[model samples]
Target: MANIVAGIGWHVIGAGMAASFYAPIEKVKKWSWETTWAIAGLFSWILLPIGVSLCLLPSFTGFYASIDPHLLLTIALFGAMWGVGNVSYGLTMRHLGMSLGIGIAIGVTLVVGTLVPPIMDGKASMLFTTRGGLYTMAGVFVALIGVAIVSWAGHKKELQLKGHLEEFNVGLGLLLAVMCGIFSSGMSFALHAALPIQEAAKSVGVNPLYAMLPSYVFIMGGGAVINLAYCFIRLAAVPRLSLREDLRQPGPTLRTNAALAATGGIMWYLQFFFYAWGEANIPASMSYVNWMLHMSIYVLCGGIVGLALGEWAGIRSGLLRLLWVGIIIIIIAANLVGVGMAYSQ
Candidate 1:
């Protein structure tokens, strides 16, 4: 019971961290997406992760060395692919608005993040052969229903906002968001494949909670590399990126840039922090549920915050109610996933 409580708490903390991540980006002024992403990458993908791993994981070096080079490379490559998704997610949010953007992204993540790892591990049968597996599969279907509802509401909202909201571009945003979900969830498969690193950490007497850091470092490092490349490419294409003039005219641009970078860095790392801790509390058989729970909470919190921030303002009351209904469906889906995991254990 205590462990379950801890798992729930950590999951909530993880969700909060994810929710707060993009808030900082809204603060960044004058800088293009390229500059902003580069700064965020430094904090999120590089400095912060290193600092945490060094501080928490005592056997970091030994464990890192013990992993197979080929496996590590594969994980890193997946991270790089996920990085592209991450960049696209930001753009999706900008174009789609929070409710629709997150709904679509989570839909993709739910499918990929939950199923891919199990399939890769050759446990695809577990999802159907066992009663618990059946429940989980059911939960996934229910969750998809919720996502559909949320997305439908978002679609309606977007239609209503067409004339009022100048920045609306629902079509492109939804497309990119779906792509983001698929690739972002790919990270879970990467982590699963790097199980050797986790074993190495166990052999070295490191706390299981901290042992996961090294794997994250490698994975996030890959993501960082890809995002850095993309940023550089954007920089090259846009000569204004070289302009010192924007820097000179900025108000809170620099400050916002620094803050966003720090926030994004910390936010990115917190997912694993909670994941590692949550893994400690749950049975290994249920690890896939962790991703579902984490992503659901993230989407829920982001949606709620978006509402609070007036992002959904001026929409009809009927539309707002519909959105809430969608949120409820997502909640049901998350609960089903959790229940299925518990039953499996």
Candidate 2:
């Protein structure tokens, strides 16, 4: 029971990190989005993953050599899929605008990422076989409902603003949003696929707490390659965008930009760092529920952050009330998952 509580605490920290990971990027100056993102991806996906894994899993480099190479490839491929999903998010924003795009995209991501792995493994039936599994599943579905309510609130808020965005294209946006959700779930798939490697880590005297660390090395390495390639392509094709923006003023400006990206990237990676810790605390049977807990807490935290940032400043009282209702629902959903985890244990 204590372990389950610890796991929920760790998951909350990770989800909060996930919620705020993009804040540093918002402060980055005079760089194209592609450039800042690419730089951030470098620290988030490559530098940090390798460095942290080495600290936690000292044999991480050699650990891969002893495992089936195919397992590594599968994990990396899913990482690439997540990369594609990450990039698609920009397009989703372009077509749908931030409030609507994020609402839809994240909603889809929450559902698909939480549920697909069990269904794929043909263990969906197990969710109904136990009280814990049933509670977890209920929480997952309720989280989705909360997401929908929140999205509706966002839609109302956006409509109350000046007007719909000029570029809004619902048809294309919907399709892209769905695609992004499916592919964004790739991160979960990559981690799920690394189950074998996690077991191997445990057998080789790796501490269970750090066993999942090595998995990030391959997952994000693959993401880094795809993300960088896309950034390079974007830099070449866009007349106004350039990697040169990174060096425009050089000296302090360059250092600041680099620092911002590094901060953002490291913050992003920290989400998984705590997530792995959370997973380490749960029994394998109930571990899959952590993703749902992560997503639920992530959405709830994101909403709280939005409120803190004054994104709700001009909103009508009714809409704000509705948003609060949604937030409360998400909080309840996350607790339900935690209770489910404790019960299962």
Candidate 3:
């Protein structure tokens, strides 16, 4: 019971990290999106994963020596696809605004990432048979409802702030957002596909907390590779946003921007840093639900971050109240998941 509670706590903390990572990037000045993103990606996806892997999984050469190349390739390929999702996620918000875009994106991620892996693994029936798994599924559905409420509230808030949504194109934005969700679920798939690596880590006596580190190398680093490719392409296409010149500039501007971007990078990496710890506590039978729990908390905390940044400024009390209601429901939903996991354990 206690372990499950701690796992939920870790997930909340991880989601909070995910929610607020972009703050530092927002403070970055005069840098193109590609520049800041690439730098942040180094920390979130590549540098940090490698650094932590060295720390936790010490015998890097030995670890990979035993694993099949096919598994690594499979996981990395999924991670690469997930990289595309990371990019499209921003575009979704650009097209649909925070509320509706987030609602749809997170909802899709919750459903797809939660169900697909188990179905693929032929363990879908366990979800139905296990009382705890059923409760967790219930919590996921409830979280989806909360997500809808929050998204609706955000849509209402936007209306109150602006006369109308500037990016109200239903056809294009909706399709793009759905595509983003599908790709976002790839990270879940990557981890699912890397189950053998987990056993290898255990065979090598790796601690539970650190077992996921090596997998992150293949997964997160693989995603970073694609992101780097995209950013480099954008940089070449737009000479004005040349990251080379930005890095060449001397003094505080470059240093300050780099520092801010790096901070954001660290913050971004912490999402999964904490996720590893959180999953260590989840019951194996109920583990498939972790993605749902994660996406659910992410949306909720994102709403809280908006509130903190005064994004809801001058909002009508009714919509504001609706946002609060949704926030409450999400919190309850997270607790319900923890409770269900407890029973399953």
Tell me which of candidates 2 and 3 scores higher on TM-score.
Answer: 2
Best by TM-score: 1
- Per TM-score, what order, best first? 1, 2, 3
User: Between 1 and 3, whose lDDT is larger?
Assistant: 3
How does candidate 3 fare on TM-score? 0.81
Runs of candidate 1 with Cα error greater than 4 angstroms are: 57-63, 118-130, 239-246, 249-252, 283-289, 342-345
lDDT of 1: 0.74
TM-score of each: 0.88, 0.83, 0.81
Q: Model 2, poorest ten-residue lDDT window?
A: 93-102
State the lDDT of candidate 1 residue by residue for 49-99, as single tens digits.
Answer: 677777766655765666778988899998888888888887877776666
Runs off by more than 4 Å, candidate 3: 92-104, 118-148, 160-176, 248-250, 285-293, 327-345
* Candidate 1 similarity to native, TM-score: 0.88
Q: For model 3, how does the per-residue alpha-carbon lDDT over 1-345 read when each residue is reduced to its tens digit?
A: 998888889988998888777667767888887888899888889889888877777588778877899999999999998988887765665555454455566665655555666678898886778887787688778767876776677556555656455555445555776678778878878987998898789778899876876898899877888888988999999857887787877778999999998998999889998998899997886674465577667777766666666556677878878877876676566666656666755
